[model samples]
Target: MEEESMEEEGGGGCEAMMDDQNHNNWGAGGYGRHLLGPAAAPLGNSLLRGPAAGPTADPELSDVPEANGVLRGCEPGKGGAGAIAAAININASTSKFLMNVITIEDYKSTYWPKLDSAIDQLLTQSPGDYIPISYEQIYSCVYKCVCQQHSEQMYSDLIKKITNHLERVSKELQASPPDLYIERFNVALGQYMGALQSIVPLFIYMNKFYIETKLNRDLKDDLIKLFTEHVAEKHIYNLMPLLLEAQSTPFQITPSTMANIVKGLYTLRPEWVQMAPALFSKFIPNILPPAVESELQEYAAQDQKLQRELMQNGFDRGDQSRKRAGEELTYNGSSACASSRGYR
Candidate 1:
């Protein structure tokens, strides 16, 4: 009876030793399974069960306290399996976030057109005309575009739109009657700037972020530069003459109109106002009344005396007199004479 009891005790010790060895082997195989994927699963199972899974790999062995811990750890509710599921969920959430992010092209196509239309309406609409789009919608669209790295492209498009509009304004000025050119230009500039005043608030975010940060200039400065390039530069020569004419002779333009032009130029950029001295120096001679110098009576008499002698010498007196009278001899002769005189 004592031998029998000793043999049973030895068997139990061997079972415990086998369980411990299986647990250690299983722990090591867990890492291998992760590194090697499904191809290593059979190897890990053979190591966990010791060469072959048979009668010795008792299903009941999993009921042991240590085995229960390992089994429970692998269940969907806990341990590495749970961690894997959580990681998957986190990745899915991140993918969803990335999918929802707005792209620059999206803003350019969707929101930017709406903003451009509103700008056009503001620029071209008559005063007191109803504008269908609200300012808030424009602000939101601009905010979204700037937040999504669409600023530079949007700003470039804005410049093109404004420049095209100003080009049209310049053409109108070019076609205007010479006396009305300054007035038309001033009216166009006022309309453009006033429209910009209404439109600027909508792009405040872009002005603060993209324009200020990337270009080191504000939107207002960029707009002024566009005006300089497209409108002011193109018509500057003609504009300067008309402006000087207007300033000297207010009968050609209202005092208020001239004042507005001056104020608008000063407000747009101090550089523009500063250019006045240079423009005056360059253009004043063209616009100014021709200087009248009294000719010496003796020299004029000598010239007339020479002309009479030529005629007396039978140089066709009627033809000579007609030539001396300075009649326009060709269709463009009068225009050539006027051009030589000064701005008319």
Candidate 2:
């Protein structure tokens, strides 16, 4: 957690807002099995990953952000047995962790119009080809909001608007082709999360001090809630099977962690269970064991292929044997962009 030192200007600095799910060692929510357990997944039940940020009272004047931070997510291939289910994205977003002390009236009149336009670009633009907008400016705007005396309302409204936009994006995702839903989700989720992560730090000072402490919520939690509710769960319902297969790769995960995976599943979206009790009561338990077994067989086949390559290379050899295996077999894991903890 980054601490804020108060100054006259009261524009403040921020730290990276870490992900709710990343390198979680609770051993409670593995990538595969626990979804069959029950509702109320323990995942992210604790909102503050590390230390809470500075008090929400008032901020210092604006300066450059402290650093860049990654939005934690499962990359295509990363982690151990339970590592199969990757996070949203490991891409870094500038934590424009800052504050500006300006009145809400100024925020509404002077800054918001421009900020709103930048948000429009964020929503309308395509992946990697975003309309150029200064993230620094957005930080400046939100920072100013935090400095005002009546910032709680400001923050709430900001979250409401942001949520509305995300809901729009979610509705758009639903229009995509059924086969292309995951691909579309990957693209949309990446872009939206990146945008949200970048600007979130602007609200961090207030979130740490006032919002989380007083309102019992923070900017990170609200953004994640919007995604989990509006976007992630719908697609995850379809993608769960594939995620289980991916996590079970190499067969390194134990049943303990596999149970954690089930926990992770229950957390994805609980509303699904309420709407259709059978999804969990009927389908999950019956299917998951077989799924795990099937993934084990796949891992075994890969292991055998590795064994054959070793034999072909005169086993018990040096790096050359390993190189040969890399060339011959798909291998246990692929390259992943990951962060162990914190923003970097």
> Tens digit of lDDT per residue, candidate 1, span 1-344?
00011111212322222333442343326534443445345334544544332232333323323221222222222223223223222234333334434566566667678888988998897667788877766776666556556777888888888888888888888889886778778878877877878877878877877678667988877787778778877877677667876654324566577767766665555555445653333322333334355645655686577667556656544544434334444337777676556423
Q: For residues 245-332, could you state the per-residue lDDT of candidate 2 as single tens digits?
A: 5344423333443444344345545555454343354335543334465578786886788677656656654455434222433333
Minimum summed lDDT over a 10-residue window in model 2 is located at 56-65
Deviation in Å, model 1, residue 324 alpha carbon:
61
Q: Model 2 segments beyond 4 Å from truth?
A: 1-105, 123-131, 241-344
Off by over 4 Å in 1: 1-100, 268-344
lDDT for residue 74 in candidate 1, whole number 0-100: 23
lDDT of 1: 0.59
What TM-score quantifies how close candidate 1 is to the native fold? 0.52
TM-score of 2: 0.43
